[model samples]
Each structure stands twice: as structure tokens, then as C-alpha cells.
Target: MRADRLVSLVLLLRRQGRMSAAALARELEVSTRTVLRDIEALSAAGVPVYAERGRYGGFALLPGFQTELTGLNHDEALALLIAGSRRGAQAFGLGSALASAMLKVVDALPESHRDTAAGAAQRLLIDPDTDLLSRRTAAEDVPDAIVAEVRRAVFAGHKLRIHYAAVDQPPKWRTVDPIGLVTVRDQGYLLATRSGDDRTYRLSRILAAEELDEPAQRPDRVDLGQAWQERSTRFRTGGDQVAVLVRLHPSRRDELVATALTVLAEDADADGRLRMELTFQDSRHAEWALWQLSTSAEALAPQWLRTTLHNRAAAIATRYEDSP
Candidate 1:
């Protein structure tokens, strides 16, 4: 709504001091012309907004001006409360801070809205660590001291040194230019650069961390989301991946998808089962996933896999044959 946009404009200017029209438009996700019109409207409504003309000039509000906007509607307040109830903050070592902030949000709400919003938030759940099958997803543990030091380096744009435990490798200390931190499904990752090359380290694998006082030699600005996506794509495509053809029971299709990295193709067979072409990280990954399904899935190709499963089944049968 225009009213919301206008209020946001005032708040942005108040927070940022001065911003060019182009910059304001980008932040507001509108056109330069729309920003100009909004500025004119604010001025007409007795707002102390002024413009400057120079190579590095833009719009600014008079220093002492302030708006008395409460900033959140009832639904917005409820949304925030619901989001705050998730476990993401705890993964980043901010559980207590999140709890305190949530209390303050509830307290600041209008009397008519406070009780209802709080009640509504209690009824909705987000990102629980487990699902219906009673299978639990373990949350990675990172010490508070380690979290604090890593966070300091990332936010302050400084160099960070860490003792990392890489897979199949001994622990070693290395220095990196901290870029940002990311969390996905309860797992935390530090995205950084070492010797001008992209590097990602799991937070759980960081045995120790130290924030260096030296400034990081990195780009002044980074699109962290895009950077993460690119790295994920590279990792997924560069490994010694394996593709397999399998006949899977209809009920177990979802399970296979969760384990496999990608589903190359899938179609329903005449037997009402699914014919799926799947890709896994490697042959072991494919075998492990298929083994979980037991008789519900059959590996149609790669005779070696079928032989391995047969041998394992024969051994199990022989072991149970003499049971009294």
C-alpha cells in the first residue's frame, strides 16, 4: 500500500541518513520516478525532506525530524512471533537472546493484539527437528566461544584462523577471509576464502577458532546467497557421482528422493511401482540407499550391486536357518 511505502520511505531515510534516489528506489523496490513522487508527497505533508545537487548528493531529512510509526500491523507482529519460535537462533547460539526479543515483541503489541497473537503463535509450529517417522535430525554442536569468535570475524570483515577437521584428513589450522555464515536444516557452514579461493567449512568440524585483528582482503560487498548457490552447484556436479536405475515401491519413492542427491527421471511402471533414475554421491551412497528399502526396491542394472545384495541376503538366510 502507498501508506506503508511512504512510512517505509520515512523510516529508511531516518535510518540511513542520506540516500540517492536510485539507491532509495532499489531499497524500496520501485522506480526512480516513484521515489521522486513519494518524496514530493512527503514534503507536501509537512515532512522536512530536502534534496541536494552535486556529484555525490541525494535526499535527506532534517536532522531532528522523527515519525511516530509503530511499524508493525497485527499480522506482521504474529508472523514475527511465529518465525522467532523456530530453532534457527539456537543453532547460531542465540537461544536466550531470541527468547528475550520474543518477550519484548509480545509486550510491545497492543493490548487487544497481544494475547491473541501470542496464542496464535503457540498453535503453529515451524521446522521441528523430527518428522512423523520418529526419525530425529541431530543439531550440530558448536561451542559458544567458537560461535562468538567466528561471528565477530564475519561481521567485522576480519581474518579468521581455525582448526578444522576435514573428512578423511587430519585436523589443521588455517587462516581465511571470512565472508558469511549459513545454516541449513540445523547444519551451519562458514563460507570463506583462502588464498583467493572459495572455501566452505562445517561449523561442527571447527575444533577451535580465533578472530584476527587484520582486515580481511575480500570484496567490499558480496551477494552471499548467490555465492552459496554457486558453491553448492559446483560441489554437486564435481564429485565422482553415480547414476542408478531402480524399481521402487510407490510408498518408498519419497524416502529414495530424500537420500539421493537428484532424481534424473521417474515414471510409473505397469506393476504400479516407480521406475526411477537416481544419482547419488557415489556407488556406496547408492547401495546404502537401496539397502534401506530392502525388498521394496530393486536395482535393475549394475549386476555387481544385485550380486552384492544377493550374497548379503544369502548370508542372512544361512545364519537364521539353524535357529531352533
Candidate 2:
């Protein structure tokens, strides 16, 4: 931890140009004496650090000097800076750690490359919370305390007790063995298990979490990727899947197919509409997808779906008919 603190201390001066001993102590959460000692250690290690006396004067790096982080070229450094710009770390409650690491990265670069790297990173944006369409993503409201506890339990190989609200279920308390944390499409999930059964809890849905004293009852060395894949496969196969046949306009064919779980068959119908056999998660899923296309697509098979659409159209028509 002291080594990390020293590195951070150096990086802080590099980033801020200079800081008073008190400022350094506050930033690193240590006493001013510790900061002065770390400054001595940095100087002894051949860092180009120096001090200036009097008001508005403090410790700073020598002009144009850098403590080159081992083996990273400018481009590789640029890539990492870009990766850090993504606020995804905030979801896992690692924001402060990510910030400190990024400071060290910039400071570690060769002086000739540091400014260029920071400037270049500024030009490249990653996941700006909103898009060109002006649709902003809802921020996940995770309590800092809950995320900290959950993250610790995952890494420490411990069980966790959580107040959870499962999909379509009321909130309830449960015990789980946390395997890992995952963020997808800006949403976070805690990959866990309950009594040896695979369970995935959306981090956003975690109402409260308590790291348990008992050790985890799960595998010590879990390959999270493989476990997630297995769970995903089972979930997909066990869900309600349906095959849909539809007549779609030529221009909308691609869009419809893109939304379906699979496009089983495709052909031109007698009237030139593109006929597509598609797979959806279920009937409700099929209805939602096709309804979005409106007149550009018409569901043909599964008479029940056809009747549902017909009834919807009839109801709309009746509304207007009754108005007059």
C-alpha cells in the first residue's frame, strides 16, 4: 500500500504540476510527514523532483522529465487512456482506484508523449451516457456501501446475504455465493449462486447486501466466462421460443430479420412481399417486434397472432367509427 501511495504521490505532482505537502497528504490520506518521507524516497530513486521555497511554491517535477512506465509505447498508452475514459468502472465501484491508476499512467509516460497522449484521449470519447439521438441512459443507482460489500465478497471468496427483488418478484432476503461481477450494455449483474444453483442478480436490483462470515460454497477457481456461457445457454434453451412467419416489405426485411432471434427461411411471396420465417423469444416478443414495423410487415402464421393483430386493428377502426 505504501508503494502504491508513493506512486500516487509522484503522479499527483506530475498531474497537478506541484502541490503543498498538506495537499499531497490530503490527497493520499496520509500525514504531511509521510508525504515528505515519500518525497525523499522518490528523489533517492532518481526521480527528477525538486522543491521551491516561499509562498505559492511547493514540490514539483523537473521541467520535461518523466518516469517512463516500463514497455508501453505511445499507441499502447493511448489505448489504455481511452479504456479508462469509459465510466464503466463506476458501476463496479472502482472509480477512485481507476482515477489513481490513470494518473500513474499519464505520469509514467515519457515527457514527450504525456501531453500528446492526454490530448489524444480527450479527442476519443467512449460511452458518453447519451447518444446523438438525445436519449440518455438512466444511471444505475447503486449504493456505494452495497457495491463495496458485494465487490469485497466476490474477491474474498465469501458468501453474501442480500435483499433482492428478482424479476417480477417482490423483494426478499436471500444468501448467495458471489462468483463475479459483470457489466453489459451499461447494466451490472452479480453472477452468483444459491445453494449450488446458478443465479444472476442485476447489480441495480440489489436492494441491500451484507458480506457473510461464512466461506463461499462455490468453486474456488471459477472461469467466469465459461460459467456465464453455460448459464446463458441453459436460459436461452429453456425459455419460451416461437417460430414466426411474416410477410415484410423489401426495404424492412433486413430490419425485421435483425430483431428476430433467428431467420429460419426467406423467400419472395406471390405478391412480391418478402416472406420470412423468423424465431422470436415468444408470442409477446413476436407481437412487439412485428408491431413496430406496422404496415411494412404482417405476421402470417400462428393464427392466434394474426387474430390478435386483426383485433387490434379492428379496435382502432371502431374508435374512429364510434367518434362520428
Candidate 3:
């Protein structure tokens, strides 16, 4: 690990010239003391690393010092550079590793193609934190320690015990044979099995985790993609899935689709509004989603849903009717 850190330290200085020890520590996720020690080690190894003295002083490599690396063609190099720009690595605690690898990629490209490839990659952006509408995307918060433990169990093929807080349920301890970890839409999930039954736990809801010494009772080789697809199919069809038919203003059509699990059918009404059949995880989910649209959407087919919304709106109106 120290060797990897030492190489990362060198590559970081190589890509970004003249970085202070404090700045280096932040980038490397270490302490300034560790950075100082690494610098001493680098210098002792005959690398011409020097420190400048001033308000903007920092460590830098001597001019013309370059590490020899294999070359990549223009498009190939740009593809890697752009992919490395994505923030997914942070979800798995590989953010620093990804940064270090990208630096090596840039350094490896032939000098003539290096600048152009890096420049072209900068022009394309993928998955910004905020959309064009200015609403910030929600990111799940999973502690570093929890993710580290979970990853260890998954890779080591050991059973894991986690204190998980399932939705609308009190927190509880669970032991499961580890399968694999997956992230979707920035939410992390642990796909495991308890007593031979498939189980999926949200990483954010995991309050604590412990990797057991016992080996996991799972297949030596497994198809994770197929497992996930099977689980998802079960989830989409298993619950008290509620299908609702609704008429929504054309402008709010996207909003309705975003909250629904499936859009079974859709068409434009005579008055230009959209008539659609959608399904949600449950009636509660359906009502909550329709409630958000308020006057812009109306539940047409499900008489129960329409009555519930009507009663809810009437209660609110009654409460405010006597207000000043």
C-alpha cells in the first residue's frame, strides 16, 4: 500500500506541479506528515524533488524530469480521461485510486497527443450533481468504515452481519452470505442471501457491519447480473403493486413517469392532456406521487385513490377555511 502511495505521490506531483504538503495530503487522503516522509524517501531515491520557499511555495520536480510510460492513441486516451471524470468511484471508496490511475494514463500518452486528448476530454461532462433544472441530485451517505467492511466481506467470501434499518421498520441485526455490492442512481445496495433466500439491503440504511470469520455459503462462481435482474423482477411484481390510470397536464407528464415504477400505457386525451396507465410499488406510493402534482394531475380510474385525494384536499381546505 505504501508503495502504491509513493507512486501515486510521484504521479500526482508529475501531473500537477508544485503542490504543498497539505494540498498533497488532501488529494492523497493522508496526513501532511506522511507526505513529508514520502518526499524525503523520494529525494533519497535520487529523484530530483525540491521545495520552493515563498507564500505560494510547494514541492516540485526538477525541470525535464519525466517517467517513461507506454503511449496510447488519441481516442483511447481521451476515452479513459473522460471516464475517470465520473464520480462513481467515490461511492466505492476508490476515488483516490481512480485519480491516481487517470494521472498515469495522461502521463503514458505520447507527449504530442497528451495535451490534445486531455483538452478534448474536458469539453464533455457526464452526470453532473445538478440537472439543467437546477435541482441537486440526492446522494446516499454511507460511512467509509461501513463500506470498507462490506467490501472486505464481499471480496473474501465471508458471511457478514449488519445492523440494517429497513424502510418503515425498526433497525435489526441480520447475518447473510455475501453475494456482491451494487450501486444504482447513486444508491448502494448489498445483494446477499439469508438462509438461502435472496435479500437486498440498502447500504445507507446499514448502521453497523461486521465481517464474520466463517466463509460464505455461496457459489464459487456466480452471475451477478442475472441475480440482480431476477431480484428486480421479483421486487417489481411481488409487492402489492398498484396500477393507476391518470390524466395529467402535458407539461407534468415527465414528473408522473419519474415517480411511477412502470408506464403501462400513455396517450393524449381529446383536451390535449395525457391519459396514462402507471403502476407504483403500492397504493401509498401511488397516492403520494399523485399528491405531489396536486392540481396538475388527476387519478381517473381508481375510485379509491380519487376519493382519498379528495378527502385529503378537503381536510386541508377545511383547516384553512377559518384562517385569517
Candidate 4:
């Protein structure tokens, strides 16, 4: 651990030029005496580190000295830079760390490949703000402390207490045995359980979190990919799932199937329209999704939803009738 701290101290000085002992101590999360000792260790180990005893200076590396810690080749360096540019790192509160590491990686690259790699990274874009459809999914920012806490619990197999804001509900504290952490579409989730029931909490919705002293009740080794898939299947299958039978123009079948949660069955109607048996999250969700297609989609079953849409359309028609 001390060796790691010494390397960090040297790197900090290399990156920051000169920092006061107190500043180095604060940055390394250690006492000023420990910083002085680490500086001494670096010097003893042939590192070109020295301290200046003036008001403005404390510790720094000799000029022209740089750490050759990166062993990445050209393609590898470009790949890392491309990954670093993604917005998803903010979900787990590693955006700053990733940026810092990326800078160091760039600095460590050889002069010959550095410009080419950096330029290539600039030309590539990951998760751009403006899409052709104008749909931008913002990355979530979990408080660093809360994310760190949940992360520790997930890794160390500790029970976690979290103040979670579930959909349509107020934030409330719950103790859960964390199964695993999952990220989908730039959003993060804590796959957990309360009393053996499967639960998934959006990291964005977690107001606060603390790792309990109690160990989580979970398997010894987990296959995260399999666990995630199993949970997803269970989730998609077991809810207040609404079934709908709709007849739509055959040309629009792909669009409806793409948007539906599941397509239970399909048949060709008498007029050659596509009759689909599909499921939605609920009535409201079904209505909202169908309404987006306008006349392209026709929700035949669930008369309640049909009535609601009929009233909504009539209100719009009345406005148009009075306008002229």
C-alpha cells in the first residue's frame, strides 16, 4: 500500500508540477508527515523528486521526467480514448476518474502515435447530444458518495440500506441484498432484493445509500450476464401486463412489433390487415404508445382505452370545428 501511495505521490507531482505538503497530504488522503516520508522514499528509489522550501513550492519532479506506465499500442490507446469519450461513465460516478486517466494515457503515448490517436478520437463521437430524431437520453449522475457506497456493497457482498425513489412513490429507505449492478442505455441500476423478492432500483432515483455491516444473502459466485437476463425475463413476464388485439395496416406491422413489449400471436384478418396479439405494461402505457401512431394504429380491444381515446379525439375535433 505504501508503494502504491508513493507511486501516486510521484504521479501527482508529475501531473500537477508542484504542490504544497498540505495539498499533497489532502490529495493523497494522508497526513503531512506521510507525504514527506513518501517524498523521501521516491528520492531514495532514484525518482527525480525533490521539495522546495519556499512559500510557493513544496514537492515536484525534476524537469523532463515523465512516467512510462502506459503500455498500450496505437489501436488500444485509440480504443480507450473512444470509450472514455462516452457519457455512460457518469452513471457510476467514474466520469472524472476516466477523464483523468484518459489524459494520462494520452500523455504516456509515444510522440509518433499520439497525434494520430488523439485526432482519431476527436473524429469519433459516442452518445452525441443531438440525434437525427432529436431524442437525447441524458446520462444520470449519482452522487459520488452514494454510488461509491452502493458499489462497495455490491462488490463486498454487503447488505445495503438505500433511500430509493420508486416510480410514482416518495423516497423511502429499504434494506436489500444487492445481487448485481446493471447499466442499460446510459442508465445504471442496482439489482437487489428485499425479503428475497427481486428488485431493481435506478441509480438516478437513489437519494442516498449506506452499506450495512451485515453481509448480503447471495450466491458465492455470480454470473452477472445470466443473472441480468433471468431477471429481465422475469420482469417482462410478471407484471400487471395488459394484452391487446389490434388490427393495423400490414405495412405498419414492423413499427408496432418494434414498440410492443411482446407479440403473443398474429394472424391475417379478412381484409388482409395484420391482427396482432400484443402485451403492454398497462392500459395507460398501451394507450399512449398506440396514440403515437395516430391512424396508423388501431387499438380494437380494451373498450375502456378506446373510449378514452374517442373522447380525447372528440375534444380536438370540437376545437377545430369552432376555429372555422
TM-score (C-alpha) between model 4 and the true structure: 0.73
Better of 2 and 3 by lDDT: 3
Better of 1 and 2 by lDDT: 1
lDDT of 4 by residue, 42-133 (tens): 78889998778877978888898977654443323433554644654666665544544565666677868877897898897777777899
Best by lDDT: 3
Shift in Å, residue 213, candidate 1: 1.2
Candidate 2 Cα misplacement greater than 4 A, ranges? 1-87, 282-284, 301-324
Runs of candidate 1 with Cα error greater than 4 angstroms are 1-85, 110-113, 265-275, 301-304, 307-324
Better of 3 and 4 by lDDT: 3
User: How displaced is residue 237 in candidate 4, in Å?
Assistant: 1.6
lDDT per residue as tens, model 3, 167-215: 8899999999989877777878899999999999888999999999999
Candidate 1: residue 256 lDDT (0-100): 92
- Could you list the CA RMSD of all candidates, in the order they appear? 16.5, 7.3, 4.7, 7.4
> Candidate 2 or 3, higher TM-score?
3
lDDT of each: 0.82, 0.81, 0.84, 0.78
Quote the lDDT for 162 in model 4: 96
TM-score of each: 0.66, 0.68, 0.81, 0.73
Candidate 1 residue-wise lDDT, 103-154, digit = tens: 4455456658966996798898776778899888788888867887898899
Arranged by TM-score, best first: 3, 4, 2, 1
